[model samples]
Target: MSLPALSPYHLSLALTLPGLLLLWRNLRFRFYASRRARKIPHAQERVLILGASSGVGRSVAHVYVKRGAKVCIVGRRRDKLDDVARECRAMARGGAQVLMVKADCADPEEMVSLRERLEEEWQGLDTVIITAGVSALRPMMSNAGVEMDPRHPPKSQATAEGLTHAISVSNAAITGNFTGPLVSALSLIPLLTLTSRSPSILLLSSAAAVIPAPTRALYAATKAASLLLYQALAIEHPQIAFTFFLAGTIEGDFRASAVDKALPPNLTSSGSGSDSSEPTPLVREANPAKHGLKVGWVAQRCAQAVDRGEKNVFTPMYMRFGHLFYWIVPAYVEWRARVKYRYT
Candidate 1:
């Protein structure tokens, strides 16, 4: 085949193509931003946050309080919830109220009580954020030891049969990572719908929902399931905004607790044994700040998404590449993921 002559016009066009595309991309992004710039009226908003005592949820509460919204923080511990409420109250603008409710979302009775409390206190909810979740880092069959608080009874005291029962109990608790949040959302739907402001439900899910995560198969499945649930809910309920956050790593004890709680009781270790005496190392304890966004920063982005009525939120926006890449070439992405996130 005969080739065309190398011309100055071709060279100039080729040289400018990259810059032209870059300019177009930037302009498109600016247009989207300008459209999302409408201010979210926060005055009189009644927001209820699950897992709000710590981590990203806690930070979200602070953001809402600052924007002059009545905020309720829920967690497992009363003391921790109280501390969070105090912090939010201090940051609140105008007369925004902060309520601390110590309730485990996994417990049906607690969720019901939470509903009653919200109805009594705020009368209705403007925003409901479900951030309560536990990590499933270890394999399903692994005999990772159960977490024992010094203040509570040690798992070492339980008999073999009792240990088996405890394991069963622990597995149920692990299931709460999904069930609890689901119940919380359903229980508060009526209140959320009745809000004076634009009602929204924000679910803080992990990027693991879409990306393959080794040694975290169960965790990934649960997250993916949650996203699917809300995506459907969004379709069914057009009047309400259902936003799902496919978030990356952030600073928190969620990983630690997940590892601790999901672990089976150590069968071999007992009192006076050297193995039992030493401290047990957690599954994966690396500084999230070194690898991912800060908790407070991610929370602010989430709040902004609510303000903008965005249906899907991705933190450290670069994560969109992985999602896009996986869909384009699943095999290639999976192969790379296996090598990059090899099971330990």
Candidate 2:
């Protein structure tokens, strides 16, 4: 479709298509998002979750299974992934059909293999949620294995993808979560229209992206870029409902300590949590809590939000600040984040 250029009237009309498309698409997914799950009670539809062995992904799997949805879990650890799969079967009412894909979500070749398997088995899924990420306790400088740090100065721990560790994770999600899954599923939109009620896509992004995590240099950058990527994609393809769940500083394995203790005097007793080895002023480390969810609490909250057809999804109540911070005062928000979390 070609159109004239430099015409005020034409330019004005050009702007109308996106807005109109968004409205129409939102209305469509309004009915389309949850229809299949709600419609097929006994024989629940399958939900494919990448990084489901732990964290929010596992919680989401259990949540859907409880409400009678079959779940497929994919993650790096076969044993851990299987454990989650077993748990899904235990909790699932209709008897969850849990499948495990034991491959790093960051590997393109493995992803290709997965795509083939999925194409054969399920073809298209009703819901796809991507919550895969990587973070390190110390900077490249601190690690002894590679001298990529200022003190040590060694090079080369790159992946076959020819990207850094952080980049590979982000690339896989972009390809698998946004590019592969979104395209593959939307490719079957015709099929979706015929079968399911509502087909929605949920993407998990960090509040750190908007806030700017200096320690997690590459990780934060890609996440920040991805947030915009989804926003633009949402505008482009409004017919498909896209929900970006901005999660907060979750209080679990992501937090580790001698013992779970109270927050500093400043934080509220209920909302705040503490840990000894997580991103502290001097160092950072990955604790299991990074994958921790209040399990059913957060999952059920998300399920209800999807049911109500809400656009923005946040886990804790405070994350509503993400909207105001990301949209209204991104610069200040980022500046403040840098002060609080980085270069200490």
- What would the per-residue lDDT of candidate 2 be over residues 1-344, giving only the tens digit for each residue? 88546688878888898999989967765765456446555256667777787877788888888767667778877887988888888887766677778865656677667656666776656666766554433332222222232223233343332224334334533553345334433444444344455565666776656555555554455556666776776787666566777776554443221111222232221211222223223333233255434655766666665554566676665667755776787877656655555443
Stretches > 4 Å off in candidate 2: 1-43, 136-197, 254-296, 322-344
Error of 2 at 67 (Å): 1.7
What are the lDDT scores of the predictions, listed in order? 0.72, 0.57
Best by lDDT: 1
**Any residue pairs clashing in model 1, and if so which?**
none
Best by TM-score: 1
- Assess candidate 1 and give its lDDT: 0.72
Residue-by-residue lDDT tens digits, candidate 1, 216-320 = 666787788778878887887787777889887776667765633433334433332233454333344356657757888888888777655677777668678
Alpha-carbon error at 52 in model 1, in Å?
0.5
TM-score of 2: 0.62
lDDT at 39, model 1? 25
